[model samples]
Target: MNAPPATRGGSALVVIDMINTYDHPDADLLLPSVRAALPGMRRLIGRARDEEVDVIYVNDNFGRWRSHHDELLAGALRGPHADLVAPVRPDGDSLFVVKARHSIFYETPLEYLLAEYGIGHVVLCGQVTEQCVLYSALDAHIRHLRVTVPTDAVACIHPDLADAALRMMERNMAVRLADSGSTGLFG
Candidate 1:
């Protein structure tokens, strides 16, 4: 497949489904991985901000149709794992997009937002590498956006599935697989 035309604007860091309440099924299984990935996520977010890159958080809405970004954040922060949510909480300047399903772009304004920002590349991070992250990467790829996923920055419920997902992303979508400390990630 041909690459999408490059945009003049720089890369954006897209945080997917990380601002979570962890109240659902499989939460127990996912928590350990989330804990392990926290530091990497923190580093990437810090670097993205330091580099003046747009930090866009695209999260699942948990079926709260009337809720907004702040509400979702507040709920997550109030959950049992507030410690986890606090470190990567969205700042005042961070862009927020609410998603209903697996893919960040599904029925969301993310495509328009990226276009408005002239973003041609997206660095994806956050939970469920085999699910949300994987689907989001595919969506970004088809949309012609260059995709990157820092392996260490994504959490997964099942390690084996997550590994397969990462490999699929790299092989099929041409996604750049890097660690959170990789330089120029936001370039």
Candidate 2:
């Protein structure tokens, strides 16, 4: 097989499904770590924005006809879990790619968005590591994007699955799993 493609320049950031559904009874298991990781993610986002690199919100639509990027942001902002995801919604210039499934690239503009932005390196952050976040990292590998995921910056409903996701990414998929401090964290 040929090498997975490379997209992006400087560095780009992709914030995954940090929606309300994953913060409560639906998938509360991952909240604490994801919550703790928020500030770091926010800082990285801020840094990315300041550097003029692209910031894409690869959000999950949750299969809503009425649901869109803002809806997802609003739901997480207004819902009971608002405190967990609010910091993620940066003010402007951030792009969004609505995803219908786990991989952000699945039936979405994710690939085009990355290519358009010339994002050659990507940092994957957001919800349940065992699911969407994990799948997207694998997809990133297939896309040939150099991937870096912060260990403490991601979480999952089940601890094992979360840990396993990181393992699979590094061992099976060859992703770079770093600590939260590696990324450019800013004001």
Candidate 3:
């Protein structure tokens, strides 16, 4: 809500697409990968809140561009994964960004939000490591924001794809990859 300019690299924690649309098999295979990161994401959320760092839920609008972020969260919360998201939740202190496209940056206020806070670094923790997660990481790299994807905090449809995505991100972009246990020094 407060979009004031900042001098420091305001650290931000991004929780991406942990939705019911991904979890329920009838919806898609999105749950498997997302579920894998739940524990780590819960940890990150607490750490970020404790450190006074911004917590942003960068989720998909499921292509419904005009949808409200809260509505999507409501829908997800009402679904089968209600128990899963009960712990990792949003409050008045958090920011929620709903994207219609794969990348949070594609036709969204993400860039403005980052710039306003001078978030030169973003701790990426979310679902679908191969899709939205990958795209967001790429966008962060292009914007020169330092990016870190906690290995255990992100998940992919397959282990191989997840490994490949992390490896490629490390090689091609200026990204730092770490397991959840190792990233304790950050927040």
Candidate 4:
């Protein structure tokens, strides 16, 4: 296997689509997996912070055009599943990028931010393994950035699709698939 991102170049732990309200459709289907994955996500976040690795949260805007990071976070915290949101909440120093679509790079400043940070590799963790995570991996690959996805840190609405997506990422995009503990997120 290739060396983890931190050894290759600057790396950031990118948390995708996790700050959610759980008020949307399929949220019920998504919650169980989110709960299952929450501990791993927390561990990864803590590890990133301890290692002084940049931790960036890239989340959907929930169609609230004017909403920013704090606003979206506040809304989620007020929702029914605050327990789910609390453990993985972004710290004050965490970088936040608002995305309007599935791919984190689509119409978002993430690519530029990554460039500004000299980030050549990104370790992605969060929800919807088959959708946002999958697409973001592709976009990262196209940008010539190395990608790593921790199997335990990503939650999904559908297990079969998520498995297929993970396989596709590893096979097609050259993404490193690992458990959150072993991903060498900080290298």
RMSD to native, candidate 2: 3.4
Instruction: Give the Cα error of residue 11 in candidate 2, in Å.
Output: 2.1
State the lDDT of candidate 2 residue by residue for 1-187, as single tens digits: 2223531444677888765556336455566677777876776777677677677888777778787777778777877777777777846788888888889888887777667656667888877788888888888788777788877667677888788888999998888887657644211
After superposing candidate 2, which stretches have Cα over 4 Å from the reference? 1-8, 21-26, 183-187
- Candidate structures ordered by lDDT, highest first: 1, 4, 3, 2
Q: Candidate 1: misplaced stretches above 4 Å?
A: 1-4
Q: After superposition, how far is residue 172 of candidate 3 from its true place, in Å?
A: 0.8
User: Which pairs clash inside model 4?
Assistant: none
The whole-model C-alpha lDDT of candidate 3 against the native structure comes to 0.77
lDDT for each candidate structure: 0.93, 0.73, 0.77, 0.91
Candidate 2 lDDT score relative to the true structure: 0.73
Ranking under TM-score, best-scoring first? 1, 4, 3, 2
TM-score of each: 0.96, 0.86, 0.87, 0.94
Angstrom error of the Cα, residue 14, model 2: value is 0.3
lDDT of 3 by residue, 21-106 (tens): 34434234556666677898888888888888888887777766677867787887887778667778788989988777888788
- In candidate 3, position 68 carries an lDDT of 87
Whole-model lDDT, model 4: 0.91
